[model samples]
Structures are given as structure tokens and as C-alpha cells.
Target chain A: MHSLTRSFLAVALLASVSAAHAHRTWLLPSAAQVDGKDPWVTVDAAVSEDLFELGANALKLDGLSITDPDGGSVQPNQTSTGKYRSSLDLKLAKSGTYRISLVSETAMASYKLNGEMKRWRGNVADLKKEVPAEAEELSVSTTLGRLETFVTAGKPNGTALKPVGSGLELIPLDHPSEFLAGQPARFRLLLDGKPLPGLTVAVVPGGVKYRGVLKETALTTDAKGEFTVNWPTPQMYWINAGYPARVNVPEGQPRPPMPAKRYNYSGTFEVLPQ
Target chain B: MQKRKLLLTAVLASALPALAAELSVKIDIPQLAVAEYHRPYIAMWLEKADGGQVTQLAVWYDQKKKDNGGTKWLKDMRQWWRKGGRDLEVPLDAVTSATRAPGLHALNFAAGKAPLGQLAAGEYTLFVEASREAGGREVVRVPLSWPPKEARSTGSKGQEELGNVTVQLKP
Candidate 1:
């Protein structure tokens, strides 16, 4: 009976790991481009098993940041969280691009404690305080993720598109707001302020509930870490890229040991009709 | 001294071309038999051979709307908006005007002027885009060389939203 319970616990753990991979986190905006003065844009943040259909959980807003066109920070006018999604309304008084992003670093661990399997998710500092030192088969991983969307009030500018030089980021070679169907949009990928080349990026258009096929487009970056996407139709698109690396821990560190680090970047872009 | 300067200016003027180059544009707003129709917002601009915007010549919108409400729909002209229209502060006395009725409107621009004085002698394309409420959008282009060695006329036609668009260059 003991061996059978152990085997079942292992299967459950494997299923949970795959479930995490199936869920995608995203931010969807009401409008990508606004022409009038002092326009307002509402954004919905969520994580779901489908591309953009809110189903899994409401994404936490603890790391939310809004960068205006002039590189100044702005606060959301209103914010709310429901069971499936978190949303915010932002007033775009500025005349250029605004970047709404949620950046977070989380440490997650799965371990066996008292003959039972358990999982813990929180910041790095809480690992020791929450998970007992006597826990067996403890495996910890850290994830640094950024999910973002862009909106232009009057004209699209590059001021807010500048990368923060940490984790994975997408640099637009062309204006993000100007993506059109049948036209190729170019972007570059950077990891920790350096080029991340030879990576496969996935582009999936939203409205999956109505379409019969997912029709996902996979693109690869070149030596310059640049990739081009020829949008098939006019709709909101979700693009994501991920990279994993083994963490190098210094000798005799007092903190809990994290074995690996994962970097994830995702963006929501709207492509207009030609 | 003033007389001498005038004499020098006259000599220089005589050395140059007798007639200043001028561009005359004729745009036709088509009358559609649709249930709901609004005067189309039009944007006319000059672009270089490589598709870079050179200058905005004209924009026709409903300037009488309350508190610049007409500017809200300017994004419907997506091509021009992406080119440079989004950056402009409308009600600009130079290039902005009220929407026109369904008819042909002729506008003349002098070469040595505020908007056109910066144009160099090269090949350029004129882009005219129009969008309407509850209607379709259309774009028409006319390619011509600046400071034409001789008079020339070029034009393009649209099936909807707009009619014939003509560009006449005078040397």
C-alpha cells in the first residue's frame, strides 16, 4: 500500500507540472490605438488553459506597472479582480505610446513532507520560512516573467518601448501599433540586456473559442535576435518566448537552494486590417 | 543701397526659372447611396520614393464638432494615421479644413511655400486617403517628379468612398 500511494503521488505531480505548462498568462487591452485626446483604455489580465479565454485564475496585480509615452509612470484609474481575471482602466493623457506590464519573480518548490507530497509558491525569501528544512526530495525553481501590452493615444512613439534590461524582452523594430494584415512586423528579443538568438517564438491569434483551428505560427530568431511575423489576419495576437537555465549558487549560501531559473516574456499586439 | 539690392535680386530672379513650380490637386468625394452617410475625412500627403512621408498638404474633417470630437475618427484612415496624421494637432490653420460635400475640390500649392519649399528635386508620390462613418475606406496614389521639366498630369480612380484624384504639376 505504501508503494502504491507513492506511485500515485508521482503521477499526480507529473500531471500538475503539465497543467502549469498548458496555462498561459496574458493581458488584453480594449483598444490598441486611440486617436482622440486623453483617451482611456481598459486592460484585462488573466491566465487560462486557452490562449486568451479566461478560465484558470486571476493574475495577481502586485507587479503591475504602467509606463507612459514620456517614460513617466502612471497609475490606473480603476482596478478590479474577479474570479477569472484582473482588470484596470488607464487614462492615456499623453500623446504617445503607453506600456502596461506585469513583471514578477516567483520561487516554486515541490517536496515530500511527512510521507505526503506538497507544493509551495512565493518569493525567494519565504522559502525557508514556509517549507520545513526536513522536507524530502525538495526541488525548487525560480521563474522571472513579463507579460505586457501596448496602447497608443495619438501617435505611437518608442519612449515607453525601451526595455528594463532584465529578463526576456521584445524590442519592436517597427511600430507595434502599426501591425497590419499581409504586412510583416519585425521585433528583436533580448535576455538580460543581451541578444537571445536561435529561439522559437510562438504567435497565436485570440478568439480561439470561435475558430476551429488554433493556427499558431512559430517563428525563429536569427543571429541578431530579430524575428519577423507576417500576420495572417486582423485580430489581437499573443506572442511568447521562454528560456530555461541552471542556477549557479554561491558556496555556503544561507538561502534555500534553487536548482534552475526560467525566463519568460509574452506580449499582446493588435493587427489591423489592410 | 536699397536700389542696388533690388537690382541684384532682379538679376537673380531673372536667372532662375521664369515661373515658380506649382502643384494643383483635384479630389472628388463620391456620393454613395447608403442608408447612413457622413462626409468622409480626407488626408493628402507627399511621400518619398522610399515611402517616407515628406509633408502633409491637406486634411478635411468635421472641425465644427464639439471639443474636437471629429479627431476621434481620424484613426480610421489607418494608413495616413500611421504615416504622420496622428502626430498633427488638428485645427491647424494651414492644412485643416471642414468636410466638403460630394463634389470635386481643387487645391493649389506653390512650390516655394511653407509646406512645399522643403521638397528637393526628386520623384515623389502623393497619397490621398478617405474614410467615412458606416462606410468603406479607400486610398489613391499619384506619382510625379518634383519641379517638372514640363507640365504633366497624373491621376488614379477609386471605386468607393472617393472618386477621381488628379495631380497637375506646372513648371
Candidate 2:
């Protein structure tokens, strides 16, 4: 029993370390809700674990797509890509909710048994066809990080607040446009159309340009996959949450090879000042 | 005499938009009776009725200083910094200038120029945000309709950081 506890502790430590290093993509807009008079809302997007440091070096723009309120496609142009920041701007033409989503291409990580120790090297897609299947038990994992946010113009009365389909999604319990400073905003996490509970949700006070470390208030969801954060000040915030899936070689059951999966979700909302 | 008459008509045609779309902004850098009085960084831009950026009219900071020292303080103007100011390399041609002192200053943009040229016959909100060192910050958003519809002019009074701000969009 003591040895089993020690092994469990070791596994827990490894999971915590990996979670700390996981990168997330964040999409932030200038305003969560705009009145009829304001013509546009500028959105800033980046892939990074730390909000201040955008991972432009490894980040690609091919996965970005925006669906406007009128069921039209709105393209966001890459405005700038500095060393620590990458930004995009969108021209909000009509009044309704705009959905900005980033769907990344799958990245593979594989480890091979070399003599006694397993060495993680090269892309699994390339190595799988070359490496001999008898020489190793391949443990490969595929990761697809997704980020999305919804902003409205005029009012959110007719806007659809339900899921528009994503691997992991955080839908605001109430209208995001109604979020005001000093109010507790609630959101529900969904994984495959069901509630996801006991996950860590982080809320960063400022947007990507915030020149500081990743200091955020971490909150946990309840049994119903709901979490709340009381915004003290009126400012831009990036809320992030993630989940992982792991599967191994089946016991006596023949099934096709499957890679483990990890899904990350991030959303940005503004707590309007009074 | 025909040549002179043609010249007069051409000049009037060119000046038509300028007379139609005019913005007279009065930014007062409050004279704080203090020792370390660094001029505040100010930015003026127009946004469409839906919150889209129209054009940046002027951004005043310490441009002449070497090594781009003045830009370091622009983050103090939070709203503009997030909008589009951070992407702009300081000392931008025709758009950047030195900081002003406490008084009323005038800025005129001709038709077929920034803002006026980009104006697409719609409603707009003029945003003026200012930030100072060791001082308070303020943002003023003014509302206006494009093409003036009928020579419409609007103005607003700042509480502390700025003075009477007026904009005229004529037809």
C-alpha cells in the first residue's frame, strides 16, 4: 500500500509540472459590448502561457476564423507581430455577436524505446512509418489548442449564447455584454456537450500587453461545471481552462491506434467601467 | 481671364471637403504647479458608430527625444495604447508631433485626407484620451454624424484634463 501511495504521488507531481508549462491561445476584444454609435471593436490575439509574452515564434495564423452576427465571414488581418506580441484587427460591420475562433493543426509528440530508456524525438507522423513496430510500444499524443470569444453590438438580446461547437468551450451563464465591474461573472465549461467539473480556471486581469508575469486568480468549477469570478475593476480579462484525455493499448481488444488528446479553452471579456 | 476663373473654381472644389469636414480640438495640458511637469502624451482618433477605428488624427508625445524615450510613457494612456497606438512606431510622418502646453490648439484635416477621406457617410464618435506623468488620466468620447447631413457641429467640455473640444462635419 505504501509503494502504491508513492507511485500515485509521483504521478500527481508530473501532472502538475506539465500543467504549469502548457501554452494557451487567448483572444481579447476592445469591448465586450458596444452601443450603436461605436463602429468597430479591435481584437488582439496571441498564443502564450504568459499574457505578456506572446509566442509568435511558433505561432501560425492559418487557424484564425471569425463568424459575424449576420452569418457572414469576417476576416481579421494580422496587424503586427513583434517579438513578444502578435495582434489582429477586425472591422465590426453589423450589429450582433461575433465569434472569433482559433483552431490549430494537430501537433504530435512520440517517444521511442532506445535500448533501455525511451527517447522523445522527431514528429510521430514521420517516425511511425520508418520505425519498426516490433521494436517499441509507441506512446503518441496529439494536442489541439482552441481559443474563442463572443462580442456583441447594440444589444445581445437576439444573440445566441449557446455553443457554436468546440473541443472545450466556456459559455457565459449570463450575457457577457451585461458584465460590469464589481460583479461576479459566471461561466460554464462544456466538454463534448457535457459539463466538465473539477478543472482549474484562471482569470487574468489585463489583456496580452500586460507587462507582468502570469499572475492570475485560479478558481475551480463546481459539480455542475460552473465557476465565478468577481471582477473588481473595469478592464480587459482573459479566462483560461483546459482538459486532457489519455488512452493506452487495449487489453485483448483490437482497436485502431489512437493518440492521447489535450484540449485548451480561453475566452476574453471586458468588465465595463461605470 | 478664363485661366484665372478656372483656377478659382478648382480651388473651391478642392476646399469643399475641408470646409465640410472640420475638427477644432482644444487640448489643455493642465499647468500643474509642480517641479517635475512632464507634458502628458495625448492621442486623438475617430471611431465609427459601432466602435471601429476610422483614422488617427494626431498623437502628441516627446518625439524629438533620442532613443525613442518618449514612447515609453505612452502606455500611461491606456485606452489608446490598446486601440492602435502600440503598433505605431513613434515619430510617424505627419501624424506625430511634440507635446503641447496649457492652452487651446487647433488641428485641421483637409478632405481626401485622413478621417475625412476615410469617412464613409456614417455615424462616428471622436475619442480623445490623455495621460500625464504624476497626474490623472481622462478620456473624452464625442458623438457625430457623417456628411454632417446638414453641416452638423458638436463639442464637449472636459472636466479636468482637457478643455472645450469641438468638431464640425459639413457637407
Candidate 3:
């Protein structure tokens, strides 16, 4: 009887301690803010699975809430990866204000994309950091569907750049002589000064082949006009688009044979692993 | 040992498609990166001089990365992307290694199989693109005459970052 009573007390004490520790480590779920017009931030949500810091956000996002300054909210769930996540149907389409914030009752730390929280003086509740604006933002279109909203930006009256009719852009990287597989090459672009949106671009080696094999992640173009497509193995291809032909005919012209331009931009390279 | 034999048998089976009438080709690139650093993924493919997809051979990338980040670099690899970036998913093991640096890389086309050299007769362009991590990008093209994949191996280059690239190709 005496041991039973002591065990009960121990259980109650342990539960309380656990609750306290969880509360102490609690942080506000973080959200990135994109302010242009139809401000929609792409949530990479790459949660680090193992953070060595004792009080780090252990990558579990069960109790997180995303709130926009314009009175909008969303709950991002984890995808196949431990790091990546996406919010469901939340749109920040307001004109006057734009900000997406996340705070975890658990950790109390908030993350805003492109925000540098260095030299913060007081508490995080009123922390103010300026998020840099994306110059030329473009919406994405995949076999899945078009990005939820149109990409918008700051500039007072700049007309919006329409999405590529087929949601595609022709990217060209130039180099002198042929590129040997292991040797590095270089080139510039005709649209260097133009404001271009982020899109999936590819390298088509041969001037003739359509629907050639692709190198993964290598298809995406970063903010910089730079792109990288790893060779699946060493091979050959041509230049073209990633999407199916969706453009309409002008009442008379036949469908262009997938726009394979010889445009003096052709070559070969060996693809041996490093 | 049985697995090795099976793999060998599979390679032989795949090679059966190459029992063609003529032609032979190969590429050589030494000094590649195989560590935990950033090396650009490269792609090579064939097309008629008029610019159309013919065949896709290889893509080098790390499958473990996110958001198609590994394949995202294909844009700079202009030629291959045009023909089939959207369609091909080169199996991870085919391109996986530690990491890659710069130097020589080579692919060979043997006799009686994919007679790459014996093209009946016409103009063709072989293209390549490099999408590096820390540096800039580049694409090179070699203009070849018909029948023989051996044509002085002419090529065009890009800008300041990717060092001088030279394609020493033959028939």
C-alpha cells in the first residue's frame, strides 16, 4: 500500500516536469513574408530532422499556425521529406498590408524568409526586419497545375509580365569549343539585362532530339539567371521546352515542331562521376 | 556472385539492341569531382543538324537533394533539356558517386550496337551544358559532318567562370 501511493506521486511529478520542459522549449512556428502584390511565398519548408541545439525546433510541426497580416491563415503539413512542407489554400492578396508570420508556443522563435534578425534588441514579438523584394517573380506551371496565384511585385505601375503561353522559356548558355565532360565551360545570355521569372529550364544536347532524358534538380533556375542540370549519365540531346505544346494556332500556321532551334548553340560533353 | 552474373546478363541483354550495321564513337574526360562539394550536372545528346531529338545518353546528379534541386541545373544543360528534361529520370545509382570536380569525362559507343558514327549521311550537332554550384554556367556544341562522327569537333563557349572547355571528339 505504501509503495503504491509513492508510485502515484512519482507519476504526477514526472508528467508536470515534462509539460514544463515542453513549454520552455516551445517556439512560435515561423512563416516567410513576400511583399509584392499577390504576395505568395513558395514554402520549401525544409525542416532539418536533426538539429544539435538542445532547444532547436525538432522538425516536428504538429502545433504550428501560419497567420498573415491581412487576416489569413494556413496549416502546412509535412510532405514525404522530413524537411519539406506546404500550406493549404492560404492567399495574401490584400493591397494595403502583406506579411506571413509563424510562431510556435513551443520554441518562441519566428523565421521570416530573406529576413536577417541580427542585432535584435528587445523581444521577438515586435521584431522588425526588412525582407528583400524579388525583382522579377513568375508563377510556376506543371503537369499538376499552375501556381495558386499570379506572381506580383512592388514597382508602382509596372505592367505585369504574363506567364509564358506554354509556361516555358528558352534558356541559352554559350561556350567556345565543345565542352569535355569533366572540363568546366562558360557563356552569357541574350536576355541578360531582362527581368526574367524563375522557371524550369533544360539542356538539349543534340539539335534534333525531342523529349531527351533530363538531369534532375538541374532543371530549376535560381534567382540568378543561372541553371544547372546534372547529366543522368553521359549522353546527348537538343534545346526545347519542359511543357507540352499548349499554344493556339493563328488560324493558319501549323504547330511548330516543338521549337527546336539550331541557333548556333550546340555541343557535347562527357559525364564521368567526380 | 549470382547477382553479378545477373547484372552481367542484363548488360548483355541491353547490348543486344546495338547489333547494328556500322559506326563507333567514344568520349574521354578525366579529373572529375567525387567529394561533398558543388559540381555542375552535365547532359549530352544527339540531334540532326536541323535540331531535333535523336537519343539521350546520360545525366549526373545527386538524388538525395530536394525540390528537384538536383535536376534543376538542366536548364544550363540546354541541349538535353530541350529534347527530354521533362521525361527522363536517370536512376540515382547510374550517376551517384561521392561528388565531382573538373577534368575529363568519357562515354563510348561500340561497334554493331548503337552505330553512333555511321549516320547514313547528314549534318548533326552534339551539345553539352554544365550547371555548377559555386560558379557560373556554360554550353558547348560540336558541328559534325555526316557518316563520320569525326569532324574537327568545332564548338562554342560561354563566359568568365567555367574555364576554357575543349571538345576533342573523333569518328
- What interface RMSD does candidate 3 have? 16.9
Q: What tens digits encode model 2's per-residue C-alpha lDDT throughout A65-179?
A: 7877866677874466556545677666787777777766353333334643232333335556645565444444455566777778775743456665657888888778778
DockQ of each: 0.01, 0.01, 0.02
DockQ of 1: 0.01
Residue range B109-156, candidate 3, lDDT tens digits? 433234243444567666655554422345556665544444244445
Error of 1 at A27 (Å): 0.3
- Top candidate (lDDT): 1
The candidate, 2 or 3, that scores higher on DockQ is 3
Stretches > 4 Å off in candidate 3: A1-274, B1-37, B63-79, B92-99, B110-120, B133-135, B149-153, B169-171
* TM-score, model 2, chain B versus true chain B: 0.81
**Candidate 2, B1-171: lDDT as tens digits:** 999999999999876765556555555555543212346678998788775865777899977566887787787678888888878777777688888877777777655665446566677788888765534467788887765645566788665566677775555
Between candidates 1 and 2, the one scoring higher on lDDT is 1
Q: lDDT by residue for model 3 over A81-117, one digit each (tens)?
A: 2323433334544432222222222111112234322
CA lDDT, every model vs. true structure = 0.81, 0.65, 0.35
